[model samples]
Target: MSDEERFVYDGAHVVDPLGDLEEEGEKSAKHNRAKVGSARPSSLLYTYGPGAIMDLPQFTIMPTGLDEWDRIWRRRGPTPPRIHAPRLRDVVRMTLRSPDVQLCPYPWQPKKHSRSPEGNDLGVPSRVFPQWLRCTGCDMLGLLSQFDYRNTHPYRTDLAVFEHAKCTGRAGSGTRKATRRTAIPARYLLACPDGHLDEFPYDLWVHRGQPCAKAELPALKMADRLAGKGASAVIQCASCDMRRPMNEAQGEAGKAKLPQCRGRHPHLDAFEPKGCPNATRLMLVGASNLWFPATYSIIVMPDSPEEKASDLADRVRTALGDKLAKYRDNLDLVRDLLGMGHVDVTELPDHDLELLLQAASVSPDTPAEQEQKLRDWDPVDLLVPEWQHLVRPIVGNRAEEPKSGLTLATRELGPGLRPEITRVLAVERLRKVNALVGFTRIDDMDRVGDLPRRLAPLTRTSRPAWTVATEDRGEGIFLQLDENAVAAWEKRVLDTDVWHSHEEAHRRNFERRFSETAEQVNHKTRLKPPRYWLVHTFAHILIREFALTCGYSAASLSERLYAWPAEGREPSAGLLICTTASDSDGTLGGLVQLSEPSRLQPVVTNALRKAARCSSDPICAMRTPQDPEDFLHGAACHCCVMASETSCERANRFLDRRFLIDLPGSGLGFFRPHG
Candidate 1:
């Protein structure tokens, strides 16, 4: 039916937009279930995850919490099919404290006409939001139950909508003059920081704090003048003219006017028994802050030795074919057979022997297939694992070896490169996986480090054992700064007044944010080494410069900073600049071409030269943290070091172009400009 765009690929991988076209007049469409509409499965992870509001073509919806998911007829929630990304899963399990947690791609039904359960079930379930709606024809307003819903969507899905079918236009003080008109949702809603959402009280607003003086079941009407902003819109009671402007329901004015939250969760279709303690802020359906997803993202590591052994075991099984089936129950027999060199099997590692034993136990795949899933997870430190991959020698072309999703190769590092940049690598291919842990309202929760209450839940029931995820594929250029040069630079510049100011600002920002929540602050909350800022700022500058050379926009590209320096690992000061599914892509031709020796030399030089003086400079370069309340960035604005929030991991904080170039009195340029 629809070509749904799934996840927003952050260049860690290729974005998988799910679905095949539903052929017109297809026989199975006749067997279609009670489907209200469809959405891109990717949206479920990024844009429309559980508890987030969305405007479908016909009506508005808030997808139910994960507790209600199903494929059609099952009474219990669905155990969505698994998708492997073990490092990410372990991190989530450790964070949520559910040791056996799993990761899965968002569920879907590829076939529409099949009479089977999957085809019969709706992909994700949702409930109509803002229960109150305004009839577009007469401005008549009421709850969804009060309006008449019409569905011709089974045959004509787009036309499914609520209509004021009996509207004789403002069923008058004396007359009627209106035809049927489609109804639209009331744009306003109320939410608290605790993530409770509810319908705006139109009656309460129109009538002040009193009961409707005219009638008990008074009909309400909304009128938009279309001349100005929220102030121009008006609400009134049909029984009596108790009118109020829409602006009264916004900001502090609305916060003062509205009642305390009942702790209503529209997605769960229930209100908390004790009610919410925090005040509810008014939100429009389209507002950006209404829903924020807290997700864990990881670049898939190169296959581990154990995983490689699993692959070899499978190949041996295939070579042995039916002959291996008879020897399945005896582990010694299988090991000896592999030892006999019928399939070129090498000395099996303990990992391979374990897999072989499992294969021997269950005759290939029995119902107990999960017995084979026991493998050690990759390290929970995301960047360290990826850093290892980035630092390794890139694989040259090999026709005989099976193709991998990730193929990286080093470009010739000639004399052209700056001495500080150790090497240039062309990541011919890469994969990134993003998993939705939960969401929040009013605040953008931090996804890094150990912090409490960083996210709200996706389900109201038990802590979920599994969550939805999506993958993206892309290629990029990796630049590793000289480690000794960076370490020396940090020791020299870290104690300056300018650097101390940044450290103070970072401390204050962290305290002001987490203190109010009353959660314990980790002692590790101190500011990190200055090279992180250098590497992070460098990544942003290159993203902007590469847009001009690589034919991708500044927004399409993203940066993954490897700068988390705590006590044990090799000090990380590298970054990956990647993009997936861009208009300018010629596969490997775009990003990889820029990493070549001839092009890379000038590219890095020009990018640094450009950062030496921002267009907004003097003012931008001279900028610093002025007030305690505002301590996010320094010497970085839209004109220079600041990057698209989607690209930069830290929401554009801890950036200072001054660290990359001399800013008058501040002589902290890590890459001092050559005369």
Candidate 2:
């Protein structure tokens, strides 16, 4: 029996590190397949990811000059192959904007596919003001939300050269100076069932150099002189079934020109380019961005912090400059309230209210007392749910609702107009939340008050006292939350409102007793926010949930044990195989290492070997597919059990084989305790 069989027979609860534990096991919430890894399914989008959708708009432009062509052909060869650059504007206008590509947002019904009416499509949603932008500098095409897609494509040398030129910011010269000269042309004939142009357009170009064929010539044979001399060798066009005559084939230079048709026909000559050195073709996966009708530049929007603040100030000043002088006239009343003890608005003199109203109107353009006006202003002019709620109960209908649906509180106000009231409330709320959750009471259910400050004297700060919200049920946990601090939580996911509540909970837990000193608080928090960011970026958005769920267990995820050692010092090469007694059985048959080992191996090998057998398939399988021709396939093979224990020396030493033993000292111990 395999080690995996042993683990199961011994009652080990095996975990698949890469498996969707939340979906496959236990009572968890159901998730949409599309939103498994992204914030699209979450309510709090702001905290979901860093590239939050802020209001400010930004743009980027792709490369558009022809000079990029010459350099590309120099390295990759002149062939009618696929090019993976940004889609041109004309392409986007003709392809993506077509009605055939669009599907209306409706339920249960199959999406209607129709061609786009020329120049008649509605533009992007007006409400969206994107602050993030990605540009394809090579094709002079700017990637837009409505346009670009991702897919693997064959590699082409010439196109690669052009793309490199744009990346390096090197513009080419001549008639080809600013135009796209690098993209060679090739025709792809369709094997149509009804010969209908309306149903299908010709396949778009993919720049990979290799052509579609039943069998490719050996790489070594292609470079050898004797191989070329073989008269029986032939080159056939995939689209038209044209075979090149031996005399016409000449050499690599002759093969470079994409064959139009087989025979020496006038139509074939017109389609084929004579002496064209860059016309090789291939079939592969590809996608296009929004191709515009005409060339356009995407200008970078002003998002600098200073500039944004300045703009807001300028607008405010422009709006309220004329009223500044009247507000400052009652400076004495303002100063009295500022210094007075816990002075509520009702306690202030009538003159103070007048001054406060005037201050609210102060504009950013005011040259003199503008600063003073802002300082004396109350932030309540901005929306404050707490103050509004409080004022309703305190004032008891002193102010009447207006017929125009406008009031002191409900009136439209810009960000600059409501500093005092909004700022104070937000800051205080942030402080409250932070202090409430901070190191006050570890188990606040029964015990309450200054969370028995357990920090050593050197690390101690001012410890605040706490009270219980519920003592009888063991439910209350005191944690202060203020506007400024709480804003961080909202800001984290404000862009999309697709926030991760679990991460928010973790953040609150960490904030209770976090410090800047790495050594002091590093190990305490395992929020993995940065890791969340990376997973979404490199892989699909759904990878985040996978990582999060797996991370719950130190054994399965093993963030600590999964070490990415420095270059040239990677782990030893040990083949891990997963086998079974028969196709029907998922149980392990046997295990072995491909080679012998030294003493300095990892202690987790035995555990890994045992765990490997516990599942029908290994947990460490790569999510991506490998090249079928590459020799490294074995390195990532899904099958390949260890040969035998004698040859598996390295694996035995690296992995603690004791984990293979049938002992009862498990995490959930089965051994009896001493009496």
Residue-wise C-alpha lDDT for candidate 2, range 294-387, written one tens digit per residue: 1111111112355333333332222334533543465455444333422234554667455454544543233234334433332222112222
Give the alpha carbon lDDT tens digit for every residue of 159-230 in model 1.
Answer: 768888777765453557546788888888888877778888888888887779889988899888584365
TM-score for model 1? 0.79
lDDT of each: 0.69, 0.21
Question: Model 1: which residue pairs collide?
Answer: 1-22, 6-42, 12-432, 13-472, 13-473, 14-472, 14-473, 28-113, 153-157
How far in Å is the alpha carbon of 305 misplaced in model 2? 11
TM-score of each: 0.79, 0.16
In model 2, the Cα lDDT at residue 29 comes to: 28
lDDT minimum window of 10 residues, candidate 2: 468-477
After superposing all C-alphas onto the true structure, candidate 1 shows an RMSD in angstroms of 8.9
